[model samples]
Target: MGASGYILRRLGYGVILLLGVVVLNFLLIHAAPGDPAEVIAGEMGGATQEMMDKIRADYGLDKPLIVQLGLYLGGVVTGDLGESYFFNQPVIELIGARIVPTILLVVAAQMIAITLGVGMGVLAARRPQGAWSAFVSVFSTIGYAAPVFWTGLMLIILFASMLPLFPVEGMESARFSGGPILYALDVLHHLFLPALTLGIIFLAQYARLSRASMIDVLGADYVRTARAKGLSERKVTFKHALRNAVLPIMTVAGIQFGNLISGALLVETVFNWPGMGRLAFDSVLRRDYPTLLGVLFFAALMVVVANLLTDLGYRLADPRIRTGGSRK
Candidate 1:
């Protein structure tokens, strides 16, 4: 129940933060100098002044800026994001359709990051003075410190161009119907490059953080107590020290997940993945305001939701979080 209350409180805060981001999205797009009608209609065809005027009226674009913003915000609260001029479809629908691939990419990259980072950190922690620890530290540093675009390009050049081991770009081959199995395989093939790129960024942070946290935990009084009690070395590290060492790493990792959803703009662009990062990049180029705003909103929503989940995870992983009972 304490954890539940903490989650509820965190969710409430997330909603408030989401609203601020939404309002900022609206204002930034609306403030960008060129008229929305001009941008929207120009993309559709060569929009005439009269047509542009009509479109503006249709979208409430001619309303006082504040009034237009009010309606947009109100409509957003009521679950309408307006229609896309380019797609001739509900903006929500377009975003919804594109979101799954992006979510998958984020999740995949996240798993890779956590697995590699935590594993390496734990390994390094166990043998602080060993060659294995040194090697893991160096590899993780490269993963973290390397620029994402550079890493992505290097991977493509190594695997795709030189070795001919993987495809150069895209989420799947156009040849298949994107079936349950074959499609999954094709996507995995296509996704490997971009996921690796994103995973490298995450891996670096996790490796460093987990290693540091573990090192610190090893020196804690409880850890010393456990060791002095004649517990097996494995039991000392895994059963006892690992749990507490992981708390800070988990907290930082949760925040990084938010970044992966937003931070892959370059990676998506490089690989031509049809994720929201790429969609937003394309939308910005075309001045597709509705699509851009919708994708941005989705990204914001993802960030908040990830943070909330991380908070829940914190409680589950570390009993001390809930036992202290300051939540609600």
Candidate 2:
């Protein structure tokens, strides 16, 4: 299929997949042991039987499961995710307020992981027995082994508490008022630790995978031909081999996008970052069904979109895919 046709096909599939996700998340979340009305009533210091019944009715929790699901699906179709039972706001509004921070965190983490990981991998692959290779191997091992929350805590202790080089928790300095540039700088400063904590594990995986892929690519006949043509070692490795090697990395990165968002739950909790992770965490604690469902829907949507983008990227990176090799 042509590029346009290919993209349209993928998008068609994405819509169907998203619908399935919505139903599954709704069922799974409702099936979990909890009563939203009870949680809300408890927060209000308790309520009478009539009050609890009214609460349930108001949130439609009194309805049959099928009715509730039908109603939710109807609302979702109309761009209404219902109001947050705990936050007392529209779920969409709540998500809008928090999504940007999560996006920033995720994007920043991906960039860090990809840039450093690919660079280290390339360096190591260049000299398989050199000191840089040894360092990359050890770094990847420890980084992959460390728990994300532990990494965040250690970073906080080393940088925020002991050395005091960065803010301990938050997306910005509360008291500081400044220009856009300075504000951006402040956010970046707070972002560094959380982003690093989230990215480090992925960085290790990328480093190892890219190193292996690069080494294999370097052994290919094309690379040998390039070397025979008297191209510089740099040109042979980077201009030819690296481009092809990146295909697998892109595939893995796209697939792992979901995991990155999920991992943010722990990272954001530890760092006290005001993102979807924190929002989802709060929603779970309060049994806020609408809010939780909204988060899951959006997270699933992101993963689906990421996969589509990965397919497009694969097509762009490798001409064979674009020219009808496994376009489906």
Candidate 3:
């Protein structure tokens, strides 16, 4: 198929996948044990039946399940996330405020991990037995095996508590009198620990994947022929092998981006960073249905988008893909 045709097909599938996520989110949240009204109330004892009835009626909690689901989906289509029963605030507004910090953190982490990982992967594969390569391989293995929360705690102990070099938790200094630049610096200090924690956790996989891909590509007949034709090592490795090798790495990186958004639930809790992951944790604890649903839906969207990009990477990596619709 043509490029536009392929894009249209992928986009159509993406829409279907996203809608399924919305449906699944609704079903799962509904399945969790609790009355919609009482869950919204979230520890009510002194309230009257009138207050409960008003709350239910006001939020459309009194509607039948099917009707409510339809209304929820409709609202999503219209970009109305509705009000959170637990917080008594609009869900969309709340998420908007929290998403930026999380996005920045994730993006920073992605850059660090991919740069270091792919670079080291290429170097190590080129000289597998070199002392520096061995050292990196050992470090990468350890980093990958280590638990993220454990790494965060250790960093906190070593840098934050022991040396006082970085903030222990939270995104920034609460009482800082500084403006945006200083505030950003403070946030970066805090973010470094968590970002490194995530980066270290991811670096091993990227490096290992890239190194293996590069090695396999280097041994291919084309690479050998290019070398026989007297291409410089740098040109042969980077211009030729690296481009083809990176396609798998791109796929891995894209999927990990989505996983990072979801997986940070633990990291956020550990660091007390007020991102979507942390917000989702709070919503679940309070049984705030709208907030929880919105968060999950967004995460699902991330996964769908990530997978789509990975598929697109196949075309970028190899021209043959443009003709045949296959990775080859």
TM-score of 2: 0.96
lDDT of 1 by residue, 93-115 (tens): 98887788888888888888888
Error of 1 at 98 (Å): 1.0
Q: Give the runs in model 2 whose Cα sits over 4 Å from its true position.
A: 326-328
C-alpha RMSD by candidate, in order: 2.7, 1.7, 2.5
Cα lDDT computed for each candidate against the true fold: 0.83, 0.92, 0.83
Candidate 3 lDDT over 1-328, as tens digits, reads 8878898999999989888889888988888897767765556654578888998899888889889999999999899888887778889988898887787777777777888899989998898778867877788888888988898888878987679887768887888897889887888888887887778778888888888898899898889888999999999999989988898888788878876776577778888888899889888888889999888887787677767877887776778777884544
Best by TM-score: 2
* Weakest lDDT window of 10 consecutive positions for candidate 3: 39-48
Q: Residue pairs in steric clash, candidate 3?
A: none
**Candidate 3 clash total?**
0
Two-way lDDT contest, 2 vs 3, winner: 2
Question: Which 10-residue window of candidate 2 scores lowest in summed lDDT?
Answer: 319-328
Give one digit per residue, the lDDT tens place, for model 2 in 1-328: 7788888999999999988999999999888998899999999999999999999999999999999999999999899999999889999999999998998998889889998999899989998999999999999999999999998899989997689988879999989999999999999999999999999989999999999999999999989999999999999999989998898999999988999999888998999989999989889889998999999999998889889988998888999877766632
Poorly placed runs, candidate 3 (over 4 Å): 42-45, 162-164, 173-189, 325-328
